[model samples]
Target: MAINEKSPSPAPAIVESEPATRCGSNTPGLAATSSNNGEKPIAHASLEERAGALAVPPPSGTTSSRYRWLVHVQFFACCWAMVVAGWNDGSTGPLLPRIQEVYGVNYTIVSLVWVFACVGFLTGAIANMFLEPRFGFGKTIFIGACFQFVGYAIESAALPFPAFVLGYAINGVGMALQDAQANGYVSNLPNSSTKMSFLHAAYGLGALASPLAATQFAQLPHWSFHFLISFGVALLDAIILAAVFRFKTHDECLAAIGQVRHLDEPSEKNDDSGSETEKSHFRKVMTLKETHLMAVFILVYVGVEVTVGGWTVTYVINERNGGPSSGYISTGFFGGLTLGRMGLIWANNKIGERKALVIYAALAIGLELVVWLVHSLVGDAIAVSFVGFFLGPMYPIAMNVCGRIIPPSLLTGSIGWIAGLGQAGSALFPFITGAISNKAGIESLQPIVVAMMAFTIGLWICVPRDKVRTASPSSSSPEGAGAIPPPPRPVVNV
Candidate 1:
């Protein structure tokens, strides 16, 4: 593989100096001058050439102190959306019995709500596969909020079960799109793994808030009121999201995060050279093998996480004799999850993301075993909370790892595919649980949870440990100069 380097200082306009490889010249490396300024001459490269450069590992000790604050802000923006979605989605578990009582349906039929939501997610994930490139991250999120608002609005009307399902399905579509794109965008930035932990913590916040929210909403006498409140929140989120869209960046999002010194390009004596150079530099991302592996891992992991959250409420209600108030059990679980993410911020700072994931996975399986053995409601509550705590970092950590393992160019699509796979799993498992509970007995749910956790443990073994290398701006640059490494490998699936 060969790399084409261009000088930072502008050169005199000329017919040609030397012919660069057909596709090899387009990439503006980390050292390349601002694309906005004509000071740095741009070069074009073929996809293969760009991929080759992307494949080169970053040197260790590279950090993004400059962009740290901006990363956190963007992360929080994504987190706010997750919190809203989690509140809407996780609340279903606690509200199921009420819905069943009001609608006069069986438990199996009631669980179908999750099926509708999962199906919608699947649709959104698939849609994101194409939409992400066209809309960019900001617009994709706003669109997702719109879908969620519509879904919530539809559900608020208290229509028949079929109508409810349709509405939930619509919401899922928006969530799936926002999730894939937001996650893809997040995975590409510096310190992404840590940022991911912080970002997912917001989901825990929403999840924790949900049962409480439902408990309060239940006091309102009409479920429609609950949906109305949710609708208002979703509308607000959409507005905030749309305003956030104005920050999109080219070349790198570095400017958005305040990492760059200037936005304006040096006044170029005009030529079509730079624009042509950048367009050619755009590269194809995923190889067939990488794509397949990503799909498998994500499918398995999401099934485990969602299944646990979705069923924990049911298990408490059916097996432990918990009432609507027992919905607090779900809160305990998300409480653990929230705490775990906070703890991970400290843990990751000490040992880095890879080691943190290894520890989190082993502990999660152990907690699941506790849930398996303990038959009492108290025991179930403890086990579920522990499960939440341990599983907290998996999604973000896995995403961080994926970003590192794959080239940046393929990031948006790769993240979308992984998210889609997870949504597919989500769609499959809740439906399976509904069907299984109808026949094998609700107790079978315990074994299903155990099995999913075990499968995740096994999958962890196949994931290659991330290797860190020290990166230099260039051979001539002295040590200690600032440099940002590529994204880390994904450790846990969503």
Candidate 2:
């Protein structure tokens, strides 16, 4: 519970100083600097006494307001990747029937694409733990974009069902990799919750547009043309992402994002024992109860969102007897989602994230009940859209909480799994809904979603009541492997 404070000003070379605790490298405490400039501080050591000298501070100069504005632009570019994710996510529900007919498979088989995609997401999420440490944030996202390109290209080829599943699976991997990076990047910044809300709002906008565009594209002779649109968007997303987060390493990437700045740090830099250090951090963070809780939280939350969106069209057309015109109701759902994120972002600040989630979720549950019970097409559509609206801010808010509790040393890995495998819910729950629908009928989607929502609430309540941790300068940077941790809590699991 004690904190060590070091003066910012350089100190004379010392033989000894007060000892610091062991295994608290990432905890925010003053790091005493020995005057020796050459040697770096010893990491992962117990009883820190005059640990090696930190690099001398370079000449300090203010970043121009103009430069700050330019950096803000990069934030928008990052949102584009989210938009692409939303587009791909939104398109799936509308395209399921078409894919089923074209592949000559049952709903159960066609839905397997979701499972494959979840597999890809889980793999990509794990891969990012190593990727970000070595390649830095920018390049990790680039690798993800590349996966999207590969996935879309393969799907666009109109190959057999297996190949099509493979393409979408790749796309899922790409989405999780980029997702983890972006959320980790943004979550640590100032006003992160508000910014995260807008960032996710871009996804809403993309999702809102997808069903309309995809439905039109599906009407074409080649239904696969929908993937082509996704492909083009991914290409643009990759270019923008590279330009925005283009750092040679995570250190530079952090500086670029205004997390840490070095007056004298050179353009090129090397991380000390980065590979081994990354592995160590990964294992260290895996021990946290919060990490696992948040992951399950994401799984349930995303599962509910994707299930409702992904199955809405099918449910409307087949179950409600609403016909093709009813397909556009997915747009209404996404529209409410878009509006909720945009409208409630600042409102969440007023009411607090936890309170807001509770209220919105209750309202969403109520509306979902309406959708389930009310057989009227117009009433169900209205209820469903409201359901989406209330669900909109849950993800960004939950992620903001994760950003608060997770240690900086393990931010990438923890967020990766939470964002990555959590997305598995998208595939997993939808697949479940489809399987159940095959037997119980598509009407099962409403009950399935309601049940999932109930489960989500339980898992959500299990997330540690997050208190925002103050980030010290060293801790703010992704390269701050030795930054201090947030407030410690007794280990408790849901």
Winning candidate number (lDDT): 2
TM match of model 2 to true structure: 0.83
The candidate that wins on TM-score is: 2
State in Å the error of residue 61, model 2. Answer: 11
Alpha carbon lDDT of residue 273, candidate 1?
40
lDDT of 1 by residue, 149-254 (tens): 9988998998998998888899888878777767765654455567677777887888788777776565456865677777887788788766655535223343
Distance from true location, Cα of 159 in model 1, Å: 1.0
The per-residue C-alpha lDDT of model 2 at residue 74 equals: 67
The stretch of ten residues in a row with the least summed lDDT in candidate 1 is 12-21
Identify the runs in model 1 with alpha carbons over 4 angstroms from their true place: 1-72, 218-220, 247-254, 258-287, 348-358, 467-494
- Report residue 215 deviation for candidate 2 (angstroms): 0.6
